[model samples]
Target: MNEDFYIDPDIHQSYTLPASVYTQQQYFDVFKKELFLPSWQWLGGKEWSDSLYTQMPHSFLPGCVDEPLLIVRNQNQLSCLSNVCTHRAKILVESPSAKPFISCGYHGRCFSPDGRFRSMPEFEAAQDFPSSKDDLKNYPLSSWNDFYFTALQPKYDLNTILAPIHQHLSSFPYDSLRPEPNLSKTYHVRANWLAYCDNYLEGFHIPYVHPTLNKAITYEDYEVRVFDHCNVQIARCKPGQKPVPLQKGDPDFGQNIYAYYWFVYPNFMINFYHWGISVNWVLPKTTDETEIRFLTYKRNDIPDSDFADTALDLTEIEDEAVVESVQKGLMSLTYHRGRFSPTREQGVHAFHRFIYTEVFADSENIAP
Candidate 1:
């Protein structure tokens, strides 16, 4: 492991992660185990609960983790189970179907939807038949509101990580939201996943990179509140601009809040707006390529933002262009690392610190 990428605890003195962190394939491999494997990842929203969509097959982070998983719904209770069969390691589920039970097509091995071993052919004489090891493995599944999440090995509680956001947005109606499939989309970028995230962690580039968004939000008042496993960027609307309505006793009751951008460490992002929330996952395809999935969940009980979808599309194009440029810049021999702006880039500083601690350090302490 490279100790040179050490991020100082203090923001004022901290240096950015070295270019090698993004350019090297080895570091990317390390990230798979250290950063992503144990972290909670957004799986899908309430839409998956539809009876027709049961037994959905998914591969966690595809090119990265590549763990075959099945989201099974048995009697309306959802569970995430390993899709690989214990017998001969064949993939159990290949496509989404409303199947009542799991069956391995390779050898006729069978199991329950919840991953319990049911029956197997020609194993009558086998010693200690149908042990617990014959059952499919189950991963940890969690939910916030109706959105589901799962992890190969969870390092922190999903609810605990999201608690701050819940408290901050006290009066925001969560149960009244539903997925807007037409508004959801994906973008492929020619840049390291971290590069895109680093750009998102701060509002420093909004004036230059996102001129339209800067005009809507008061950039000078932008604030980032960092927690142990997540960080939120609060963007307040400009004078005379429309702000998301807030109730009394809310955290930002008097402020003209535009949106709350919550970044769960490593990949997932949830941007809360008056109309709804845009959920994003920065999935890694390779050392230098990334796939970003944007899912829009709109509110049913309130008026929606007329321009939210357009704004999302425009901002993504601008961000993609700059991040792709940074990918090319990382390959340059002249630049290695940069410094952080203590006031404006606290979120970025905290992110680098997380990478350093989780990916490089020998200890797990995150505080400075």
Candidate 2:
């Protein structure tokens, strides 16, 4: 409820959303249309290989907004299809598998790997026979390293959003890093997904909220660099921590350790840690609820030990505490909006600007 901030048009600046955006159900309803549906998001990684097609259907977003989808490696091409049967809309592919074609258990409607309608029980008299409408809905899918990405209404190119990070990390052996299932976990937080993202946009609270992690990385050397709808904060690791060599001829050479914190606009965080990489995806279940999925990949066969588990758990719990508190505070009747620190909050500002552009672009009354 700090009111010292103003939206500066000269520099193309704006403040973060007021508390109501996180607390009120009405606002959250609009947020889904204005923010979530339009932005490019991280679905899941490309861990499902060609040989693993006929396994079990994976839940894309389970429990909250359960949009069941099927992933199949058909004719050597990876395809994602809506799991609902084209005949009666019954859920198909209950589990993952390597199957030649997807058959609906309810009525025998069959679909090809590319989501095309192939056969049905009694459809000979239909006028639009084998029409595209009968096929499963297909979403755009792309991949980086072994990680797969998708978008609902992808307005911008994935390459444009991820190009800089890709160039910087080109030489790093990301593909070599294997998924360590034991290290991955998910947390259901009682807060807006954006609230969680705001907490991650800066290192300002690190010295207080994450004492151990703060000590491991120097806050003074922390620098936030903004890109197109994305930002990267480079945090130099404390001495004695293992160092990750920068790509040859890269500008960030000679650094003892590199902690690359990347925020893909809307709600995905890809953190390049000293050990390997960790992907944090914030999925909105409702106005005041979010599901955070943490997937970790490791290099050099690092064993899953107590120290590693404790460090990860502590970091997550600390983040949840802060974000959840912020969500509650945003619900207060007296709260409104707050100012941004010009030096430390560039990431937050960049994100707000991106949101305004995506949401208010068509409104004639709103200034461009």
Candidate 3:
């Protein structure tokens, strides 16, 4: 039987997820399969500079999963396929291009752009040739704007993960948001991926850790909303800070909304300002290390300097220092578990419950 880990539904009775979940290799291995693969992961950017969107071939979860995949756009239809050769397991596509179809560089095995197996050299002599095995395997794909996502085996509905995000910002002109290469940055943190996420899921640290951010947004009004498979923390503007004018009929109308920080389970985050969107994709590279990519997209009216990198970068530095300390402390024999703040840490508790539930879905007995 799988080792069970329980997180109480009642926040008042619950403790944080066990320290082993962050520090142990066994739990990390389990999460890679049961938690991450079943949840949709941020694959790649689909922002094309050309008139036609070309065939995009890239490795899925580059450092970790290392699954070879190709994003094929044929006649405006998009599909994701295994980039491995059917003949001898050679990688099919290595780069992005405007190719009509895929031909394995190793043996010249050919497939249609949408992954339909067309032909292969010298295979005419083979008996019972060209069955379903010859075709490239396709994964279920979903998109939000130019971004793409897919699961190895899906547990949650893609729409359920996305609908809330869209409805919240449905009134905005989404197509106007364009990618800004200069504003995008990547950083490696010497901490568990979940630790970084846990720190982000709550605003409890803003007052003490992020003084500038604390001044920009009122600490008393900050709110975190937990959804089915995601959560969002809303920040209201402080006295001198400018609030993104909330439209009438909107859920947050009459409030001074500063930023809409949304966390889509496991790793991806979409932080929306009136100026643009800051997308954070946290990738688990190892049990104790994670790589975070900060991709920014904004409307033309929003100046490059308006993105607030100063506050963002400074806040990140402070956050890293704290979470890194927590990472080191997790290794201590005395630090087994911690408690959650009922009012301020419901999001963190929600995340723990999710991890426990996903990891123990097939367990013979639940943990006490």
Candidate 4:
């Protein structure tokens, strides 16, 4: 496998990322370390903040970047710390429960909720024993409204990636929206995670794959806007539907918008609809399998029936079929790569370019 892959800055001239990126085990392993480990991950909203799950033990990117982590809530503050003990590497928090501090079950090593070294039964006589090394490792955590995100080492700013959503939908009643447990679902797709994202990064397949969705949104008016760390696909609503109420002076003001499909690089999607927000977390389980978590939150003011058709489970099934087929096709020897459609696939082009840059950012002459 080549360590370097080039994606031309000009979409007209550039080719998509090679098939190996989605098919080869070597590339998959490298991506888990170079691409995902340093990228922000979405940790569900509000529930992490509730007093009920103060000491929740989370497996960071399970099956991919499998790292044990603990979400510690101290008063109103939240912290992401290494769940492993400093002494014997035992997992400190096995499950979510209300706990005042962290204690290792293997021994008597204890630490404060904030991950500070507090006590260790057998270390009193040891010199430099209760030093910084004794404390749990802390990870970076960021929030947008009620939602939370964390990273082992974030490569892009979470705020910058989420700016498009905030800028276009500032009037959105964030506080009024609450997670709907019944609406949330996990889909296991038989495809490379990137294949699912590539399918999501464009509206080119809507007409071909999602016939029901095509009728609700004007296909010709679909627009893709690429930002520093993210991209958005803006769909114009059909004649009878109500558009998102953007603040006056905004570029999208007065337009009958259907939804803003925002894709944050690496693997996170936030879709804003008439009734609420739908989040898709594309989690890579293996080179050929991905776990897609569909998390929904509904606004208190909007009736259940007002939710957009795009939010339907049928749409997800349509997407899964297309993506799974793409995954299979990528393994074919005849198809190694393809060119980007400048007008229609800018989001897909941007996504491929990001993968090239992140995977081979250290290489020289990557341009063209």
Candidate 5:
């Protein structure tokens, strides 16, 4: 398996990723280190006020990456850091606290709000004991609206990677959106994470599977816009439904654009609706299991029909059924590869190309 492989760059001339990606444990275990860890992913849709620091302790893609992360807030600045103490490998910040200081529970070591080492007990006699290495390891952190993102070794600047999101939503008043914990949800799906992502990257199944969402959206006018490291699917509202009106100079000005289903590279999804946003994170648990989290942020008052829990549940149920079935079908030796609709599946194709380039490229160039 050390030999390098390739994913055909041209979608028109390419086959889908091997079925083993969704069915075999060897592939998952191998890719877990080189690919998933360094890639940018949504950490449980954890939203924090960029203006204020909120202690947010989250596991990165819990089951698959399972990296314990700490989001620290000191005064007005925010940062993400390794939750493990470097001194003795002890977990730090077991829970969120309002204090403006951090202390390692294992020893008397202390760090400032920004993760810089401040003080240590009984180290006066130690030669050069306190250094930058003793500081809490910090991760790169950034935000778009209420969404916060972090990566240990991001391949590119997150601002550059998500430029599409910022450009498309530049004119919107999404700043009004506030985190609503009561509305967030999590679901365990009996399917591989990639299988779940595959289903999410297309809308061809909406009419067949999601009757409620189908009624809310017009299938004819929907469009998919592909970008580097991300993709956007336009969901125009059906008759009688309202959209947060677009302003002049906005990309979709003068259109009843109900939502923008934005899928960032890998497993993060930001579904923007008039009422608010439904942020989805696909967390891989095992070869055939995944945990999907839906964290909601509301901008203002929402009508029951536009953003109701029951409506969301119905859509999820339909999607889960289809993705789970696909997972089962991939187990068949008779089915190994399939083609994509050149028009409808560009997003899925783009996602596959990204997965291949990052996971299977000359791994010698990858960081250890």
Candidate 6:
């Protein structure tokens, strides 16, 4: 295999990994270990906070990933717990609803809202009846502007990842923004998660792949600003076109904007428009399959009729087609890593640097 397919940092250029990275199971395994587990990802919003506070447990991943977890709100405090019974390890809280306590359907093991071991059936005869291990395992969780975030491995501090966006978005009233459920949708793409992200990191292909979107935003005025583990690409609106009004004192208040595309590390993209915000979460299913979830939250109500039919879907379809085509081409023996256009693809280059640092940093440090 041509290992040089991986981008060489020494080259100081924007280049992608060899095609095998998209097609090989070995590469996928490495990514799962080195990338996903350690990363802080956007799971769900705060809509479930009330339910959790009511002792109604909701599961994050069901059958596919099958991580049994429960969220509960008690005494004005919210907590997440492993949804496994303390007694026989039976799963707890299969469905979501308000309940006073959690009881295993199998052996009658019960836990309090805080995941403390409350009761067990027929355990009086046991010698070590009440050990600390009987309590459900709790995970670290934090909330920002009505959004709940958690991590499994939690290699880096959550604040480090969120600090930049928090500082940038401080002026906006994010807490008041209600999620528009009708605008939310998920699309399955036949490409790697990174490939989908690479497509998003730059507007290099907008003129070619997205003619309609290209018309909306001036291509020459496009600019990318990079931050730690995140990048913001400003899409300048055409002359004479009115831009979305920013919150008072916002730096970009007067600038005309077709869109503000913000990509957070690993797998989240916050796309801001005059009308509202669209949060895109990209989840990798397999080596070659990815699921992209788009959650649209309206900041300002704009008539759906004002835009073209299937506007979001068309953009997604165009993106899907191109990324899938790239995935296929990556498998060819002749194709290897390619160069990055510094002017147009700084965002993509920044992303590649992040991936390399996350995956191979330790390896590089230990090597001779």
Models, CA RMSD each:
2.8, 3.5, 2.4, 2.6, 3.2, 3.2
Q: Give the Å shift of residue 66 in candidate 3.
A: 2.2
Q: Note the residue pairs that clash in candidate 5.
A: 53-73
lDDT of 2 by residue, 92-140 (tens): 9876666788888998988877888889878789786888889989877
lDDT of 6 by residue, 3-72 (tens): 4544555435446655566677766767776776676656566556544445545444321244667777
CA error at residue 292 for candidate 6, angstroms: 1.1
Ranked candidates, highest TM-score first: 1, 4, 3, 5, 2, 6
Best candidate, lDDT? 1
Candidate 4 versus truth, CA RMSD in Å, comes to 2.6
**Model 2, global lDDT:** 0.73
* Residue pairs with clashing backbones, model 4: none
lDDT of each residue in 151-185, candidate 3, tens digit only: 77889888888888776776654567877778788
- Candidate 3 stretches with Cα past 4 Å from truth are 1-4, 45-53, 361-368
Superposition-based RMSD of candidate 3 using all C-alpha atoms, in angstroms: 2.4
What's the TM-score of every candidate structure? 0.95, 0.89, 0.93, 0.95, 0.91, 0.89
Candidate 1, residue 328: Cα displacement in angstroms equals 0.8
The stretch of ten residues in a row with the least summed lDDT in candidate 3 is: 44-53
Give the higher-lDDT candidate: 4 or 6. 4
Report lDDT (Cα) of residue 339, candidate 4.
90
**TM-score of candidate 2 versus the correct structure, residues matched by position:** 0.89
Candidate 3 residue pairs in backbone clash:
none
What do the candidate models score in CA lDDT, each in turn? 0.87, 0.73, 0.80, 0.86, 0.79, 0.73
Candidate 4 lDDT, tens digit per residue, 48-122? 786576799887788899899999988878889999999989999898878787988888899999898899887
